[model samples]
Structure formats: structure tokens, C-alpha cells
Target: DQQVKQNSPSLSVQEGRISILNCDYTNSMFDYFLWYKKYPAEGPTFLISISSIKDKNEDGRFTVFLNKSAKHLSLHIVPSQPGDSAVYFCARETSGSRLTFGEGTQLTVNP
Candidate 1:
């Protein structure tokens, strides 16, 4: 079974604070980890990604870390801003056709 789990459906953080989202996967075959940020009805845009070969990947304010042994991953947003408020989805690409996504975690950046 391919199941990606984001236990927290939502999270709120004050602006300029750190925001962290966690995800877990049951499938061991997953090799590509990705995080996508989405606002409202718009399609999700890629934020950062890490292959099973890497432990971490960072871009600007977004950083993702993967622990293959634990089958867990997390996304960290440093000094989050109001504009950063959105739904973050953690996904694993295994089959090459599409990614298996977590339920989603809504990050609210409070001003």
C-alpha cells in the first residue's frame, strides 16, 4: 500500500517564526521526496525536493530533510511570512506516473 501520512492537518505560526510540517510514508520503494505549496484552488507548485540519495535540500526559505531509515520527512520554513500561508503537501514519487501525497497540512502565517 502506498500511503503518505501527514498527521497534522493544519498548523499556525506567527510571522517570522519557524514552521515545520511532518510526513511519513509506509512504502519503502519511494525514492523521490517532494514538497508542494498550494493556495486556494490553484494547483500546487513545487517547493523543494530531495532524492533518497540526499539527506537534505534547501531553497531560499524552504528546506526539506529526509530520513530514509525512519521513512520520515519534514519541511521547514524559516521566518515564515504571511504570504507563506498555504496548504503544503508532501508527496513521494515512486511509480514514475504520479506522486503519492499526504492528506495536506495547512500552514497559517499569522501577522
Candidate 2:
């Protein structure tokens, strides 16, 4: 079974709106969670991250929230832009360099 999962395969939003992406993990051993953004034919780039100890973390337009009890995490993007449209991936990192990523959630921002 996959340790991490993205429940939503895709999301569509209008420009200047909010985009919410969700993720869940079955393993409690994950120490950190990260969100990555990827474009077609390009490598994924790190977007945001939050430690297991932290309930929430925010950076500019992006915010990440972790609910340890539920083993769930969510990413929020305010004023979603067309440029922000891409495949968003949620990842869990262990003590080692290995990062387990959830199936990506594709976000489309329509103008």
C-alpha cells in the first residue's frame, strides 16, 4: 500500500481565487512534509514544507497545514494565478534522504 496519497487528482480554480490541495499519509514515522510544484517536461521544484512538530507554516501566498492526529496535510494558495497552474505533489520525508511523494494533484487556474 502507498504510504502517501493525494485524494484529489485535479482541481480547477479561477484566477485570484484560493486553491486548496489535500494529502494524507499512513505512516507516522514521517518527520517532515513538503509540497512541490511541477510543470510538464520539467522537474518538480520545492514549494513549501512544515516539520511534524509544526501545525502550520506559511510563505507568501502558500500555506501548509499539518494535522498529526488525522495524518493529513493541506496546502493553500491564495489568489491563485495562472502561473501557479501545475501538478502539485505532497511528500513525506524520513530521517534519511528518501522522500515518499503522493500522486500529484493537478491544479488549473482559469483566467
Candidate 3:
């Protein structure tokens, strides 16, 4: 069974608008959540993260929110720009040095 899921396959937004990506997980033991942005052929880069202790964490234009009780999380990007277009993946770090990742949501920012 897949522990992590990104319900939306893709998202489109105009430049300067906001983009919201949703993710859900089934594993209750997950204490750390992370969002990664990947380009066409490059590796995924870490974007933002949130620990189970906090409800939200923000970094520049990226914000990650986690709901431990519901096993859900979301990434928000405000004033999205063209360069921000990428495939965003939600990941969970397990205690066994393994990271579980969602399918990923492709974001398109129109200029």
C-alpha cells in the first residue's frame, strides 16, 4: 500500500498568483514531512519541511502545513513565478533512514 499520495496530478496558476498542492499519508508514525521541487532532468531539491510538533513552517514563498491527526499535509506558494514551475513531491522521513515520496504534482506557472 502506498503510504503517501498526491491526489492532484497537476496544477496551473498565473504568475503572481498562489498555488496550492495537497498531499495525504496513511502512516501515523511519520513525524517529519518535506516538500521537494524537481526539474525536468535534474534531481529534486528540498523546498520546505514541517515537524510533527508544529502545524506550519514557512520559507520565503513556500509554506508547508501538517495535520498530524488527519495525516495530511499541504504546500502553498504565494506569488508564484514562471521559474517556480516544477514537479513537487511530498516526502516523509521514516526512522529506518528511508524516505517515502508521493507521486508528485506538476505545477505550471504561466507568465
Candidate 4:
């Protein structure tokens, strides 16, 4: 069973629009949730995170909302730009120190 799932492998949207990425988890024990953004060959960079205790966290153009009851989380970007195009990965800090990551969602922003 996939503890974490990114239902869609890719998403495309026109520039200056809203881009939403969704994630679901089967494990309810995940305490720390994070979203990372990666470009091409580089490693993923931390974007936003929400603790199991909180419901939402935001940074600049990115926002991560966690609904603990539903075991779901989403990342939203507004006025999305061309530079925003990249592979986004949702990760969870499980009981183990190593992180568990989603397969990833490739976002394509049309210029």
C-alpha cells in the first residue's frame, strides 16, 4: 500500500493562474508533513510544512494546508508563473528518520 499518493503524475496550467497540487496519506501517524519543489536535475528544496497539530502553513506564493481528519494535504500557488513549473514532491517525516516521499507531480506552467 502507498502510504503517500499523488493521484496525478502531472498537471498543466496557464501562467498567472491558480495551481493546486493534492496529496493523500494512509498513515495517520505522520507528524511532520512537508512539500518540496525540484527543478530538473537538482534536489528538492523545502517549500512549506505543517505539523500534525496545525491546519495550514504559508510562505510567499506557496501555501500548504493539512486536514488531519481527512488525512489529506494540498499545496496551492496563485498567479502562477513560468518559473513555478517544476516537480513537486510531498514528503512525510514518519517514525523513522528517513523521509517518505510521493512519486511526484510535474507541474507545467504555460507561458
lDDT of 2 by residue, 1-53 (tens): 43889989999999999999999999687678999999999999999999978
Cα RMSD of all models vs. native, in order, equals 0.9, 1.2, 1.2, 1.3
* Per-residue C-alpha lDDT of model 4 across residues 2-47, encoded as one tens digit per residue: 3888999999999999999999999677678889999998999989
Q: Estimated TM-score per prediction?
A: 0.95, 0.96, 0.95, 0.94
| Every candidate's lDDT | 0.92, 0.93, 0.91, 0.90
What does the lDDT come to for candidate 3? 0.91
> Could you give candidate 3's per-residue lDDT for residues 1-111 as a string of tens digits?
538999999999999999999999995776788899999999999998888899999999999988778888999999899999999999988878578899999999999
Candidate 4 at 1: error in angstroms?
7.0
- TM-score rank order: 2, 1, 3, 4
Candidate 1 per-residue C-alpha lDDT over 56-111 given as tens digits, one digit per residue, 9 for 90 to 100: 99999998988889989999999899999999999888786588889999999999
The residue pairs that clash in candidate 2, if any, are: none
After superposition, the stretches of candidate 1 with alpha carbons farther than 4 Å from their true spots are none
RMSD of 3: 1.2
